[model samples]
Target: MEAEACKKCGYTEFKKGKLGNGYVNLMPINSFFSSGSPMIVTFCGHCGEVSSVSVEKPRKF
Candidate 1:
């Protein structure tokens, strides 16, 4: 995950969560075959500004 800076206030602090939270389970048998995963979307909480967003999936365990 990459950290982002706010455009307006230049603030840097963001939360990270799954793209589809609790929508489905992580398994190979199910229909959900996630070839490429999601990346961390960072935003400024104080100014409510979108600092930066990245979609680079991490290496599978």
Candidate 2:
């Protein structure tokens, strides 16, 4: 991915991370039995500001 500035802190360095565990994936509303996708997180390394949060499989939701 290309480097982008953080919206909150104007930092140029960002880190990639995940937000969900084995049982904590993002699920669709009213769909309890469906398996969900892992949430991908992007944040600024300098100021610990979250830049974006997204899912690996958006069609799953």
Best by lDDT: 2
The digit string of per-residue lDDT tens for model 2 on 1-61 reads 8668888888898899987786888999999777888899988999989888899888987
Write model 1 residue lDDT over 1-61, tens digit each, in one string.
7655667887677655445343432323343455554545666678766555555444531
* Clashes per candidate, residues 3 or more apart or on different chains: 0, 0
Residue-level lDDT for 29 in candidate 2: 94
Which residue pairs collide in model 2, if any?
none
- Find the 10 residues in a row with the least total lDDT in model 2: 2-11
Leading candidate by TM-score: 2
TM-score, cand. 2 vs. native: 0.80
Q: After superposition, which runs of candidate 1 have C-alpha atoms over 4 Å from their true positions?
A: 1-5, 10-14, 21-34, 58-61
Weakest 10 consecutive residues of candidate 1 by summed lDDT: 20-29
TM-scores, one per candidate: 0.42, 0.80
